[model samples]
Target: MMNIQKWLKHLSFASMAGMFLILVMGALVTKTESGRGCGDDWPLCNGKFVPAYTIESFIEYSHRFVVGVVGLILLATTIMVFLYSKRKDAKWYVGGAMLFTVLQAILGAMAVVWPQSSAVLALHFGFSLLSFAFTLLLYLVYTRFGGAMNKGDGTRLTSGVRWAVWGVLIYSYVVVYLGAFVRHTEAVGGCIGWPLCNGQVIPEMAGGTAIVFIHRVAAALLGLSILTLFLFIRAQASRDSAVYQAALYSLILVTLQILSGGFVTLAIGYDIYLLASLLHAMLVSFLFGVLCYLGIASVQTAERSSAKAYAASRLP
Candidate 1:
Protein backbone atom coordinates (compact mmCIF):
# COMPACT_ATOMS: atom_id res chain seq x y z
CA MET A 1 0.00 0.00 0.00
CA MET A 2 2.81 2.39 0.83
CA ASN A 3 4.55 1.58 -2.42
CA ILE A 4 1.37 2.19 -4.34
CA GLN A 5 0.93 5.56 -2.65
CA LYS A 6 4.51 6.48 -3.49
CA TRP A 7 3.96 5.54 -7.12
CA LEU A 8 0.86 7.70 -7.23
CA LYS A 9 2.88 10.63 -5.98
CA HIS A 10 5.43 10.12 -8.75
CA LEU A 11 2.67 9.97 -11.35
CA SER A 12 1.13 13.19 -10.09
CA PHE A 13 4.39 15.04 -10.34
CA ALA A 14 5.07 13.68 -13.83
CA SER A 15 1.62 14.73 -14.98
CA MET A 16 2.17 18.18 -13.57
CA ALA A 17 5.45 18.54 -15.45
CA GLY A 18 3.80 17.27 -18.63
CA MET A 19 1.08 19.87 -18.33
CA PHE A 20 3.70 22.60 -18.03
CA LEU A 21 5.43 21.31 -21.17
CA ILE A 22 2.16 21.35 -23.04
CA LEU A 23 1.59 25.00 -22.15
CA VAL A 24 5.08 26.09 -23.14
CA MET A 25 5.05 24.12 -26.40
CA GLY A 26 1.61 25.43 -27.28
CA ALA A 27 2.82 28.96 -26.64
CA LEU A 28 5.95 28.37 -28.71
CA VAL A 29 3.88 27.07 -31.61
CA THR A 30 1.94 30.30 -31.58
CA LYS A 31 5.00 32.49 -31.02
CA THR A 32 6.71 31.09 -34.07
CA GLU A 33 3.54 30.95 -36.17
CA SER A 34 3.93 27.17 -36.45
CA GLY A 35 0.30 26.17 -35.98
CA ARG A 36 -0.07 25.44 -39.69
CA GLY A 37 3.10 23.39 -39.79
CA CYS A 38 0.95 20.32 -40.33
CA GLY A 39 -1.13 22.18 -42.90
CA ASP A 40 -4.54 21.79 -41.23
CA ASP A 41 -3.92 18.13 -40.51
CA TRP A 42 -5.46 16.61 -37.36
CA PRO A 43 -3.90 13.65 -35.45
CA LEU A 44 -1.65 13.12 -38.45
CA CYS A 45 1.01 15.38 -39.83
CA ASN A 46 -0.05 16.57 -43.28
CA GLY A 47 -2.36 13.54 -43.50
CA LYS A 48 0.52 11.11 -43.08
CA PHE A 49 1.93 9.44 -40.01
CA VAL A 50 5.32 10.67 -41.16
CA PRO A 51 5.23 13.71 -43.39
CA ALA A 52 7.93 15.84 -44.91
CA TYR A 53 9.49 17.89 -42.17
CA THR A 54 9.93 21.62 -42.08
CA ILE A 55 10.91 23.56 -39.00
CA GLU A 56 7.29 24.53 -38.50
CA SER A 57 5.89 21.07 -39.13
CA PHE A 58 8.36 19.50 -36.72
CA ILE A 59 7.52 21.92 -33.92
CA GLU A 60 3.78 21.59 -34.41
CA TYR A 61 3.86 17.82 -34.74
CA SER A 62 6.06 17.52 -31.68
CA HIS A 63 3.61 19.54 -29.64
CA ARG A 64 0.78 17.24 -30.77
CA PHE A 65 2.74 14.15 -29.83
CA VAL A 66 3.64 15.49 -26.40
CA VAL A 67 0.04 16.42 -25.75
CA GLY A 68 -1.05 12.88 -26.55
CA VAL A 69 1.38 11.37 -24.04
CA VAL A 70 0.60 13.95 -21.38
CA GLY A 71 -3.12 13.29 -21.79
CA LEU A 72 -2.65 9.59 -20.99
CA ILE A 73 -0.54 10.21 -17.88
CA LEU A 74 -2.99 12.82 -16.62
CA LEU A 75 -5.90 10.44 -17.14
CA ALA A 76 -4.11 7.67 -15.29
CA THR A 77 -3.30 9.98 -12.38
CA THR A 78 -6.93 11.05 -12.14
CA ILE A 79 -8.12 7.44 -12.08
CA MET A 80 -5.58 6.52 -9.41
CA VAL A 81 -6.89 9.23 -7.11
CA PHE A 82 -10.43 7.91 -7.42
CA LEU A 83 -9.38 4.32 -6.83
CA TYR A 84 -7.01 4.84 -3.95
CA SER A 85 -8.04 7.99 -2.11
CA LYS A 86 -11.28 9.12 -0.48
CA ARG A 87 -10.26 12.76 -0.43
CA LYS A 88 -12.92 14.84 -2.12
CA ASP A 89 -10.48 17.62 -2.93
CA ALA A 90 -8.15 15.20 -4.70
CA LYS A 91 -11.02 13.87 -6.75
CA TRP A 92 -12.09 17.40 -7.71
CA TYR A 93 -8.60 18.32 -8.81
CA VAL A 94 -8.26 15.15 -10.84
CA GLY A 95 -11.76 15.46 -12.27
CA GLY A 96 -11.19 19.05 -13.27
CA ALA A 97 -7.95 18.06 -14.99
CA MET A 98 -9.65 15.27 -16.93
CA LEU A 99 -12.50 17.50 -18.09
CA PHE A 100 -10.31 20.37 -19.16
CA THR A 101 -7.72 18.11 -20.76
CA VAL A 102 -10.41 16.77 -23.09
CA LEU A 103 -11.70 20.26 -23.75
CA GLN A 104 -8.21 21.50 -24.52
CA ALA A 105 -7.68 18.66 -26.96
CA ILE A 106 -10.98 19.29 -28.68
CA LEU A 107 -10.19 22.95 -29.06
CA GLY A 108 -6.80 22.10 -30.53
CA ALA A 109 -8.45 19.72 -32.97
CA MET A 110 -10.93 22.36 -34.03
CA ALA A 111 -8.15 24.81 -34.74
CA VAL A 112 -6.35 22.22 -36.88
CA VAL A 113 -9.35 20.84 -38.79
CA TRP A 114 -10.94 24.22 -39.33
CA PRO A 115 -9.51 27.59 -38.65
CA GLN A 116 -11.03 29.45 -35.72
CA SER A 117 -11.59 33.11 -35.02
CA SER A 118 -9.09 34.89 -32.78
CA ALA A 119 -11.59 34.83 -29.90
CA VAL A 120 -12.01 31.07 -30.27
CA LEU A 121 -8.28 30.54 -30.53
CA ALA A 122 -7.78 32.58 -27.40
CA LEU A 123 -10.16 30.27 -25.53
CA HIS A 124 -7.96 27.32 -26.51
CA PHE A 125 -5.10 28.73 -24.46
CA GLY A 126 -7.46 29.53 -21.60
CA PHE A 127 -8.58 25.90 -21.41
CA SER A 128 -5.00 24.75 -21.53
CA LEU A 129 -4.18 27.09 -18.63
CA LEU A 130 -7.06 25.64 -16.56
CA SER A 131 -6.02 22.05 -17.30
CA PHE A 132 -2.47 22.85 -16.30
CA ALA A 133 -3.58 24.63 -13.14
CA PHE A 134 -5.65 21.66 -11.94
CA THR A 135 -2.91 19.14 -12.62
CA LEU A 136 -0.49 21.27 -10.61
CA LEU A 137 -3.02 21.39 -7.80
CA LEU A 138 -3.16 17.58 -7.76
CA TYR A 139 0.58 17.51 -7.29
CA LEU A 140 0.26 20.09 -4.56
CA VAL A 141 -2.04 17.71 -2.67
CA TYR A 142 0.55 14.98 -2.44
CA THR A 143 3.42 17.35 -1.76
CA ARG A 144 1.60 18.92 1.22
CA PHE A 145 -0.09 15.76 2.48
CA GLY A 146 0.16 15.34 6.28
CA GLY A 147 -1.67 16.69 9.31
CA ALA A 148 -3.12 19.46 7.12
CA MET A 149 -4.72 16.94 4.81
CA ASN A 150 -5.96 14.49 7.47
CA LYS A 151 -7.72 17.01 9.68
CA GLY A 152 -8.56 20.49 8.50
CA ASP A 153 -6.01 23.06 9.65
CA GLY A 154 -7.27 24.83 12.80
CA THR A 155 -7.19 28.25 11.15
CA ARG A 156 -10.51 29.60 9.91
CA LEU A 157 -10.67 31.98 7.00
CA THR A 158 -13.17 34.82 6.98
CA SER A 159 -15.74 35.44 4.28
CA GLY A 160 -13.81 38.46 3.06
CA VAL A 161 -10.58 36.51 2.56
CA ARG A 162 -12.45 33.84 0.60
CA TRP A 163 -13.98 36.46 -1.66
CA ALA A 164 -10.67 38.21 -2.26
CA VAL A 165 -8.82 35.00 -3.10
CA TRP A 166 -11.54 33.81 -5.48
CA GLY A 167 -11.79 37.22 -7.06
CA VAL A 168 -8.04 37.41 -7.76
CA LEU A 169 -7.91 33.90 -9.16
CA ILE A 170 -10.80 34.49 -11.53
CA TYR A 171 -9.56 37.92 -12.58
CA SER A 172 -6.10 36.54 -13.32
CA TYR A 173 -7.67 33.99 -15.64
CA VAL A 174 -9.52 36.78 -17.42
CA VAL A 175 -6.32 38.73 -17.88
CA VAL A 176 -4.62 35.60 -19.19
CA TYR A 177 -7.39 35.12 -21.76
CA LEU A 178 -7.00 38.72 -22.87
CA GLY A 179 -3.27 38.12 -23.27
CA ALA A 180 -4.06 35.06 -25.37
CA PHE A 181 -6.39 37.15 -27.52
CA VAL A 182 -3.63 39.65 -28.11
CA ARG A 183 -1.26 36.90 -29.17
CA HIS A 184 -3.72 35.11 -31.47
CA THR A 185 -4.85 38.37 -33.06
CA GLU A 186 -1.22 39.39 -33.71
CA ALA A 187 -1.85 42.44 -31.58
CA VAL A 188 1.31 41.96 -29.52
CA GLY A 189 3.36 44.22 -31.72
CA GLY A 190 0.68 46.87 -31.78
CA CYS A 191 1.97 48.62 -28.69
CA ILE A 192 5.57 48.94 -29.99
CA GLY A 193 6.83 49.72 -26.45
CA TRP A 194 6.48 48.77 -22.80
CA PRO A 195 4.25 50.71 -20.32
CA LEU A 196 3.30 53.02 -23.14
CA CYS A 197 1.86 52.43 -26.57
CA ASN A 198 4.28 54.16 -28.89
CA GLY A 199 5.06 57.49 -27.18
CA GLN A 200 1.79 57.97 -25.31
CA VAL A 201 0.17 56.67 -22.12
CA ILE A 202 -2.75 55.66 -24.32
CA PRO A 203 -2.46 54.99 -27.98
CA GLU A 204 -5.24 55.29 -30.52
CA MET A 205 -7.93 53.01 -29.07
CA ALA A 206 -8.67 51.57 -32.47
CA GLY A 207 -7.53 48.57 -34.50
CA GLY A 208 -5.09 46.01 -33.05
CA THR A 209 -3.66 48.68 -30.78
CA ALA A 210 -6.91 48.86 -28.91
CA ILE A 211 -6.81 45.13 -28.10
CA VAL A 212 -3.25 45.36 -26.83
CA PHE A 213 -4.10 48.36 -24.69
CA ILE A 214 -7.00 46.55 -23.10
CA HIS A 215 -4.84 43.55 -22.22
CA ARG A 216 -2.21 45.80 -20.64
CA VAL A 217 -4.79 47.58 -18.56
CA ALA A 218 -6.34 44.31 -17.48
CA ALA A 219 -2.94 42.92 -16.49
CA ALA A 220 -2.17 46.00 -14.43
CA LEU A 221 -5.46 45.64 -12.62
CA LEU A 222 -4.71 41.96 -11.97
CA GLY A 223 -1.40 42.83 -10.35
CA LEU A 224 -3.13 45.27 -8.07
CA SER A 225 -5.78 42.71 -7.14
CA ILE A 226 -3.12 40.17 -6.21
CA LEU A 227 -1.35 42.72 -4.06
CA THR A 228 -4.63 43.29 -2.24
CA LEU A 229 -4.97 39.55 -1.65
CA PHE A 230 -1.47 39.34 -0.22
CA LEU A 231 -2.25 42.11 2.21
CA PHE A 232 -5.50 40.44 3.22
CA ILE A 233 -3.76 37.16 3.95
CA ARG A 234 -1.07 38.83 6.04
CA ALA A 235 -3.65 40.63 8.14
CA GLN A 236 -5.20 37.38 9.42
CA ALA A 237 -4.00 37.06 13.04
CA SER A 238 -4.32 33.28 13.26
CA ARG A 239 -3.97 32.51 9.59
CA ASP A 240 -2.46 29.21 8.58
CA SER A 241 1.22 29.76 7.85
CA ALA A 242 0.67 28.11 4.45
CA VAL A 243 -1.70 30.87 3.39
CA TYR A 244 0.71 33.60 4.46
CA GLN A 245 3.61 31.93 2.70
CA ALA A 246 1.61 31.39 -0.48
CA ALA A 247 0.48 35.01 -0.44
CA LEU A 248 4.05 36.26 -0.17
CA TYR A 249 5.00 34.08 -3.13
CA SER A 250 1.97 35.32 -5.03
CA LEU A 251 3.03 38.91 -4.54
CA ILE A 252 6.49 38.14 -5.87
CA LEU A 253 5.26 36.10 -8.83
CA VAL A 254 2.87 38.85 -9.93
CA THR A 255 5.69 41.38 -9.84
CA LEU A 256 7.85 39.07 -11.94
CA GLN A 257 4.99 38.49 -14.38
CA ILE A 258 4.58 42.22 -14.92
CA LEU A 259 8.30 42.64 -15.32
CA SER A 260 8.43 39.82 -17.84
CA GLY A 261 5.76 41.61 -19.83
CA GLY A 262 8.01 44.61 -19.98
CA PHE A 263 10.91 42.42 -21.07
CA VAL A 264 8.79 41.05 -23.92
CA THR A 265 8.05 44.58 -25.04
CA LEU A 266 11.71 45.55 -24.86
CA ALA A 267 12.63 42.53 -26.93
CA ILE A 268 10.17 43.59 -29.59
CA GLY A 269 11.24 47.21 -29.48
CA TYR A 270 14.94 46.46 -29.96
CA ASP A 271 14.38 43.55 -32.36
CA ILE A 272 16.69 41.67 -29.98
CA TYR A 273 14.41 38.67 -30.11
CA LEU A 274 14.73 35.85 -27.53
CA LEU A 275 12.77 33.53 -25.26
CA ALA A 276 11.43 36.44 -23.29
CA SER A 277 7.99 35.36 -24.36
CA LEU A 278 8.47 31.88 -22.93
CA LEU A 279 9.74 33.36 -19.66
CA HIS A 280 6.62 35.52 -19.52
CA ALA A 281 4.36 32.49 -20.04
CA MET A 282 6.25 30.54 -17.37
CA LEU A 283 5.80 33.25 -14.75
CA VAL A 284 2.08 33.41 -15.40
CA SER A 285 1.78 29.63 -15.18
CA PHE A 286 3.49 29.53 -11.78
CA LEU A 287 1.44 32.49 -10.61
CA PHE A 288 -1.80 30.74 -11.55
CA GLY A 289 -0.76 27.50 -9.85
CA VAL A 290 0.05 29.33 -6.60
CA LEU A 291 -3.31 31.09 -6.76
CA CYS A 292 -5.08 27.72 -7.08
CA TYR A 293 -3.21 26.43 -4.01
CA LEU A 294 -4.35 29.38 -1.91
CA GLY A 295 -7.92 29.00 -3.08
CA ILE A 296 -7.93 25.38 -1.89
CA ALA A 297 -6.14 26.18 1.36
CA SER A 298 -8.68 28.88 2.16
CA VAL A 299 -11.49 26.32 2.26
CA GLN A 300 -10.18 24.56 5.39
CA THR A 301 -13.20 25.16 7.61
CA ALA A 302 -13.56 25.51 11.40
CA GLU A 303 -16.83 23.53 11.84
CA ARG A 304 -14.78 20.35 11.64
CA SER A 305 -11.83 22.05 13.26
CA SER A 306 -13.19 21.78 16.80
CA ALA A 307 -14.41 18.26 16.10
CA LYS A 308 -10.93 17.24 15.05
CA ALA A 309 -9.46 18.93 18.09
CA TYR A 310 -11.86 17.16 20.43
CA ALA A 311 -11.22 13.83 18.74
CA ALA A 312 -7.49 14.36 19.15
CA SER A 313 -7.95 14.73 22.92
CA ARG A 314 -9.37 11.19 22.99
CA LEU A 315 -6.33 9.79 21.19
CA PRO A 316 -4.04 7.62 23.39
Candidate 2:
Protein backbone atom coordinates (compact mmCIF):
# COMPACT_ATOMS: atom_id res chain seq x y z
CA MET A 1 0.00 0.00 0.00
CA MET A 2 2.81 2.40 0.84
CA ASN A 3 4.54 1.65 -2.42
CA ILE A 4 1.33 2.21 -4.35
CA GLN A 5 0.88 5.56 -2.66
CA LYS A 6 4.40 6.63 -3.51
CA TRP A 7 3.90 5.61 -7.11
CA LEU A 8 0.75 7.67 -7.31
CA LYS A 9 2.59 10.68 -5.89
CA HIS A 10 5.36 10.29 -8.40
CA LEU A 11 2.88 9.98 -11.25
CA SER A 12 1.11 13.11 -10.10
CA PHE A 13 4.36 15.05 -9.96
CA ALA A 14 5.33 13.86 -13.41
CA SER A 15 2.05 15.00 -14.90
CA MET A 16 2.48 18.47 -13.46
CA ALA A 17 6.02 18.69 -14.71
CA GLY A 18 4.90 17.71 -18.18
CA MET A 19 2.24 20.39 -18.11
CA PHE A 20 4.88 22.98 -17.13
CA LEU A 21 7.10 21.92 -19.98
CA ILE A 22 4.22 22.22 -22.43
CA LEU A 23 3.75 25.81 -21.30
CA VAL A 24 7.41 26.58 -21.89
CA MET A 25 7.33 25.01 -25.32
CA GLY A 26 4.20 26.94 -26.23
CA ALA A 27 6.01 30.13 -25.30
CA LEU A 28 8.82 29.08 -27.52
CA VAL A 29 6.44 28.47 -30.41
CA THR A 30 5.02 31.96 -30.07
CA LYS A 31 8.38 33.60 -29.46
CA THR A 32 9.88 32.01 -32.52
CA GLU A 33 6.85 32.87 -34.70
CA SER A 34 6.36 29.18 -35.41
CA GLY A 35 2.65 29.24 -34.78
CA ARG A 36 1.90 29.02 -38.49
CA GLY A 37 4.76 26.74 -39.37
CA CYS A 38 2.35 23.86 -39.69
CA GLY A 39 0.06 25.98 -41.86
CA ASP A 40 -3.19 25.87 -39.91
CA ASP A 41 -2.79 22.21 -39.01
CA TRP A 42 -4.83 21.14 -36.03
CA PRO A 43 -2.74 18.25 -34.69
CA LEU A 44 -0.51 17.67 -37.69
CA CYS A 45 2.47 19.56 -38.99
CA ASN A 46 2.14 20.55 -42.69
CA GLY A 47 -0.53 17.92 -43.31
CA LYS A 48 1.85 15.16 -42.25
CA PHE A 49 2.50 13.30 -39.02
CA VAL A 50 6.09 14.19 -39.65
CA PRO A 51 6.53 17.34 -41.66
CA ALA A 52 9.21 17.69 -44.33
CA TYR A 53 12.29 19.50 -43.06
CA THR A 54 11.91 23.09 -41.85
CA ILE A 55 13.00 24.74 -38.58
CA GLU A 56 9.66 26.40 -37.77
CA SER A 57 7.70 23.27 -38.64
CA PHE A 58 9.92 21.19 -36.41
CA ILE A 59 9.44 23.53 -33.43
CA GLU A 60 5.68 23.61 -33.84
CA TYR A 61 5.43 19.87 -34.43
CA SER A 62 7.57 19.07 -31.42
CA HIS A 63 5.31 21.17 -29.22
CA ARG A 64 2.32 19.22 -30.49
CA PHE A 65 4.02 15.95 -29.62
CA VAL A 66 4.80 17.18 -26.12
CA VAL A 67 1.21 18.30 -25.61
CA GLY A 68 -0.09 14.91 -26.70
CA VAL A 69 2.22 13.08 -24.34
CA VAL A 70 1.31 15.34 -21.43
CA GLY A 71 -2.36 14.87 -22.10
CA LEU A 72 -1.98 11.11 -21.90
CA ILE A 73 -0.02 11.34 -18.66
CA LEU A 74 -2.66 13.55 -17.12
CA LEU A 75 -5.37 11.09 -18.10
CA ALA A 76 -3.48 8.25 -16.52
CA THR A 77 -2.81 10.21 -13.34
CA THR A 78 -6.47 11.13 -13.02
CA ILE A 79 -7.59 7.55 -13.42
CA MET A 80 -5.04 6.30 -10.94
CA VAL A 81 -6.13 8.85 -8.34
CA PHE A 82 -9.77 7.92 -8.75
CA LEU A 83 -9.02 4.24 -8.30
CA TYR A 84 -6.66 4.51 -5.33
CA SER A 85 -7.47 7.68 -3.41
CA LYS A 86 -10.31 7.52 -0.92
CA ARG A 87 -10.25 11.22 -0.18
CA LYS A 88 -13.22 13.06 -1.75
CA ASP A 89 -11.13 16.21 -2.28
CA ALA A 90 -8.50 14.29 -4.17
CA LYS A 91 -11.10 12.71 -6.41
CA TRP A 92 -12.70 16.05 -7.21
CA TYR A 93 -9.35 17.66 -7.97
CA VAL A 94 -8.51 14.88 -10.37
CA GLY A 95 -11.83 15.24 -12.15
CA GLY A 96 -11.43 19.03 -12.46
CA ALA A 97 -7.89 18.65 -13.78
CA MET A 98 -9.03 16.27 -16.48
CA LEU A 99 -11.74 18.67 -17.56
CA PHE A 100 -9.40 21.67 -17.75
CA THR A 101 -6.78 19.73 -19.62
CA VAL A 102 -9.28 18.89 -22.32
CA LEU A 103 -10.42 22.47 -22.55
CA GLN A 104 -6.83 23.65 -22.83
CA ALA A 105 -6.21 21.30 -25.72
CA ILE A 106 -9.33 22.46 -27.51
CA LEU A 107 -8.33 26.11 -27.20
CA GLY A 108 -4.87 25.33 -28.51
CA ALA A 109 -6.25 23.54 -31.55
CA MET A 110 -8.71 26.32 -32.29
CA ALA A 111 -5.93 28.89 -32.19
CA VAL A 112 -4.12 26.96 -34.91
CA VAL A 113 -7.11 26.27 -37.12
CA TRP A 114 -8.91 29.58 -36.87
CA PRO A 115 -7.79 33.10 -37.56
CA GLN A 116 -7.35 34.00 -33.93
CA SER A 117 -6.51 37.60 -33.18
CA SER A 118 -3.81 38.59 -30.77
CA ALA A 119 -6.31 38.75 -27.90
CA VAL A 120 -7.37 35.16 -28.47
CA LEU A 121 -3.79 34.00 -28.73
CA ALA A 122 -3.09 35.79 -25.47
CA LEU A 123 -5.91 33.82 -23.86
CA HIS A 124 -4.15 30.63 -24.95
CA PHE A 125 -1.43 31.25 -22.38
CA GLY A 126 -3.95 32.08 -19.67
CA PHE A 127 -5.86 28.88 -20.31
CA SER A 128 -2.67 26.84 -20.35
CA LEU A 129 -1.64 28.37 -17.01
CA LEU A 130 -5.03 27.48 -15.55
CA SER A 131 -4.52 23.88 -16.57
CA PHE A 132 -1.09 23.92 -14.96
CA ALA A 133 -2.57 25.39 -11.77
CA PHE A 134 -5.18 22.61 -11.57
CA THR A 135 -2.54 19.96 -12.06
CA LEU A 136 -0.49 21.43 -9.20
CA LEU A 137 -3.55 21.45 -6.98
CA LEU A 138 -4.18 17.81 -7.79
CA TYR A 139 -0.60 17.00 -6.86
CA LEU A 140 -1.01 18.72 -3.50
CA VAL A 141 -4.17 16.77 -2.82
CA TYR A 142 -2.38 13.55 -3.63
CA THR A 143 0.50 14.43 -1.33
CA ARG A 144 -1.76 15.23 1.59
CA PHE A 145 -4.07 12.26 1.11
CA GLY A 146 -1.16 9.84 0.82
CA GLY A 147 0.24 11.15 4.15
CA ALA A 148 3.33 12.43 2.43
CA MET A 149 2.49 15.92 3.68
CA ASN A 150 0.96 17.46 6.79
CA LYS A 151 -1.39 20.37 7.09
CA GLY A 152 -0.01 23.29 9.01
CA ASP A 153 -1.69 24.21 12.26
CA GLY A 154 -1.31 27.93 12.57
CA THR A 155 -2.95 30.76 14.49
CA ARG A 156 -6.18 32.05 13.02
CA LEU A 157 -5.64 34.94 10.65
CA THR A 158 -7.50 38.21 11.06
CA SER A 159 -10.04 38.90 8.35
CA GLY A 160 -7.77 41.61 6.96
CA VAL A 161 -4.93 39.20 6.29
CA ARG A 162 -7.27 36.72 4.69
CA TRP A 163 -8.71 39.35 2.38
CA ALA A 164 -5.27 40.68 1.52
CA VAL A 165 -3.93 37.28 0.49
CA TRP A 166 -7.02 36.57 -1.57
CA GLY A 167 -6.76 39.93 -3.25
CA VAL A 168 -3.13 39.41 -4.17
CA LEU A 169 -3.79 36.05 -5.75
CA ILE A 170 -6.74 37.36 -7.75
CA TYR A 171 -4.88 40.44 -8.95
CA SER A 172 -1.93 38.36 -9.96
CA TYR A 173 -4.08 36.69 -12.62
CA VAL A 174 -4.86 40.09 -14.11
CA VAL A 175 -1.20 40.87 -14.26
CA VAL A 176 -0.64 37.56 -15.98
CA TYR A 177 -3.22 38.34 -18.66
CA LEU A 178 -1.68 41.73 -19.30
CA GLY A 179 1.72 40.19 -19.66
CA ALA A 180 0.34 37.68 -22.14
CA PHE A 181 -1.18 40.53 -24.08
CA VAL A 182 2.19 42.17 -24.30
CA ARG A 183 3.59 39.02 -25.85
CA HIS A 184 0.74 38.28 -28.25
CA THR A 185 0.58 41.85 -29.47
CA GLU A 186 4.31 41.84 -30.13
CA ALA A 187 4.74 44.74 -27.73
CA VAL A 188 7.61 43.31 -25.76
CA GLY A 189 9.98 45.90 -27.18
CA GLY A 190 7.47 48.69 -27.66
CA CYS A 191 8.99 50.75 -24.90
CA ILE A 192 12.65 49.71 -25.33
CA GLY A 193 13.43 50.44 -21.67
CA TRP A 194 12.72 49.14 -18.18
CA PRO A 195 10.69 50.90 -15.41
CA LEU A 196 9.94 53.58 -18.00
CA CYS A 197 8.57 53.55 -21.53
CA ASN A 198 11.36 54.87 -23.76
CA GLY A 199 12.74 58.02 -22.10
CA GLN A 200 9.43 59.14 -20.66
CA VAL A 201 7.95 58.06 -17.35
CA ILE A 202 4.78 57.37 -19.35
CA PRO A 203 4.82 55.77 -22.75
CA GLU A 204 2.77 57.19 -25.62
CA MET A 205 -0.56 55.38 -25.87
CA ALA A 206 -0.11 54.24 -29.47
CA GLY A 207 0.14 50.91 -31.23
CA GLY A 208 1.65 48.15 -29.07
CA THR A 209 3.14 50.71 -26.73
CA ALA A 210 -0.15 51.14 -24.91
CA ILE A 211 -0.55 47.43 -24.26
CA VAL A 212 3.04 47.11 -23.08
CA PHE A 213 2.58 50.09 -20.78
CA ILE A 214 -0.50 48.50 -19.22
CA HIS A 215 1.48 45.36 -18.68
CA ARG A 216 4.20 47.31 -16.92
CA VAL A 217 1.66 49.02 -14.68
CA ALA A 218 0.06 45.69 -13.83
CA ALA A 219 3.45 44.19 -13.06
CA ALA A 220 4.24 47.07 -10.70
CA LEU A 221 0.95 46.54 -8.91
CA LEU A 222 1.63 42.81 -8.65
CA GLY A 223 5.04 43.48 -7.13
CA LEU A 224 3.55 45.79 -4.52
CA SER A 225 0.84 43.28 -3.73
CA ILE A 226 3.31 40.47 -3.19
CA LEU A 227 5.52 42.69 -1.05
CA THR A 228 2.54 43.54 1.12
CA LEU A 229 1.64 39.86 1.46
CA PHE A 230 5.20 39.04 2.46
CA LEU A 231 5.23 41.68 5.19
CA PHE A 232 1.86 40.48 6.45
CA ILE A 233 3.08 36.89 6.55
CA ARG A 234 6.07 38.01 8.59
CA ALA A 235 3.98 39.91 11.14
CA GLN A 236 0.81 37.83 11.34
CA ALA A 237 0.03 34.87 13.55
CA SER A 238 2.59 32.12 13.47
CA ARG A 239 2.43 30.13 10.23
CA ASP A 240 3.54 26.63 9.45
CA SER A 241 6.90 26.20 7.84
CA ALA A 242 5.38 25.16 4.53
CA VAL A 243 3.23 28.26 4.36
CA TYR A 244 6.11 30.50 5.36
CA GLN A 245 8.44 28.90 2.88
CA ALA A 246 5.99 29.06 -0.03
CA ALA A 247 5.33 32.74 0.56
CA LEU A 248 9.03 33.51 0.82
CA TYR A 249 9.72 31.61 -2.38
CA SER A 250 6.95 33.48 -4.17
CA LEU A 251 8.50 36.82 -3.23
CA ILE A 252 11.86 35.67 -4.46
CA LEU A 253 10.46 34.47 -7.79
CA VAL A 254 8.59 37.71 -8.32
CA THR A 255 11.82 39.62 -7.70
CA LEU A 256 13.69 37.46 -10.16
CA GLN A 257 10.89 37.84 -12.72
CA ILE A 258 11.23 41.61 -12.45
CA LEU A 259 14.95 41.42 -13.02
CA SER A 260 14.47 39.10 -15.98
CA GLY A 261 11.91 41.45 -17.43
CA GLY A 262 14.46 44.26 -17.23
CA PHE A 263 17.14 42.15 -18.84
CA VAL A 264 14.88 41.16 -21.71
CA THR A 265 14.07 44.80 -22.30
CA LEU A 266 17.63 46.12 -22.07
CA ALA A 267 20.41 43.60 -22.56
CA ILE A 268 18.79 40.90 -24.73
CA GLY A 269 16.38 42.85 -26.92
CA TYR A 270 13.05 41.33 -27.86
CA ASP A 271 14.19 39.82 -31.14
CA ILE A 272 16.69 37.49 -29.46
CA TYR A 273 15.22 37.27 -25.96
CA LEU A 274 12.88 34.37 -26.64
CA LEU A 275 14.54 32.20 -23.99
CA ALA A 276 14.37 34.94 -21.37
CA SER A 277 10.73 35.69 -22.13
CA LEU A 278 9.87 32.02 -21.95
CA LEU A 279 11.66 31.79 -18.60
CA HIS A 280 9.62 34.73 -17.39
CA ALA A 281 6.46 32.93 -18.41
CA MET A 282 7.55 29.72 -16.67
CA LEU A 283 8.32 31.55 -13.42
CA VAL A 284 4.89 33.14 -13.41
CA SER A 285 3.28 29.75 -13.95
CA PHE A 286 5.17 28.35 -10.96
CA LEU A 287 4.26 31.39 -8.91
CA PHE A 288 0.59 30.83 -9.72
CA GLY A 289 0.87 27.26 -8.54
CA VAL A 290 2.30 28.43 -5.23
CA LEU A 291 -0.41 31.05 -4.87
CA CYS A 292 -3.10 28.46 -5.48
CA TYR A 293 -1.60 26.21 -2.83
CA LEU A 294 -1.52 29.04 -0.32
CA GLY A 295 -5.12 29.92 -1.09
CA ILE A 296 -6.28 26.36 -0.50
CA ALA A 297 -4.26 26.10 2.68
CA SER A 298 -5.89 29.25 4.01
CA VAL A 299 -9.35 27.87 3.34
CA GLN A 300 -8.57 24.54 4.93
CA THR A 301 -7.23 26.29 8.02
CA ALA A 302 -10.40 28.35 8.31
CA GLU A 303 -12.65 25.33 7.94
CA ARG A 304 -10.82 23.34 10.62
CA SER A 305 -10.94 26.29 12.99
CA SER A 306 -14.66 26.73 12.45
CA ALA A 307 -15.27 23.03 13.11
CA LYS A 308 -13.27 23.14 16.33
CA ALA A 309 -15.20 26.18 17.54
CA TYR A 310 -18.56 24.50 16.83
CA ALA A 311 -17.51 21.29 18.59
CA ALA A 312 -16.29 23.19 21.67
CA SER A 313 -19.55 25.16 21.89
CA ARG A 314 -21.57 21.97 21.81
CA LEU A 315 -19.45 20.47 24.62
CA PRO A 316 -19.92 23.61 26.77
Index of the highest-lDDT prediction = 1
Tens digit of lDDT per residue, candidate 1, span 1-316? 8887887789989988998999999999999999999997799999999879799999999999999999999888988999996667778888998898899899999999998999999998888889888888787777763334335455566778877888898889999999899889988888888888887997999988899889889989988998887887778734446777777888999999998998898898454444988888888999998887777766664445556779999999
Worst 10 residues of 2 by lDDT: 144-153
Tens digits of per-residue lDDT for model 2 on 260-301?
A: 777777855446587778778888998888877766666655
Each candidate structure's count of clashing pairs: 0, 0
lDDT of each: 0.84, 0.78
lDDT, candidate 2, residue 141? 66
CA RMSD for every model? 3.2, 2.1
Query: Which residue ranges in model 1 land beyond 4 Å of their true spot?
Result: 145-151, 237-240, 269-274, 301-316
Displacement of the residue 93 alpha carbon in candidate 2, Å: 2.6
Residue 291 Cα positional deviation in candidate 2, in Å, after optimal superposition: 0.7
User: For model 1, what is the C-alpha lDDT against the true structure?
Assistant: 0.84
| Whole-model lDDT, model 2 | 0.78
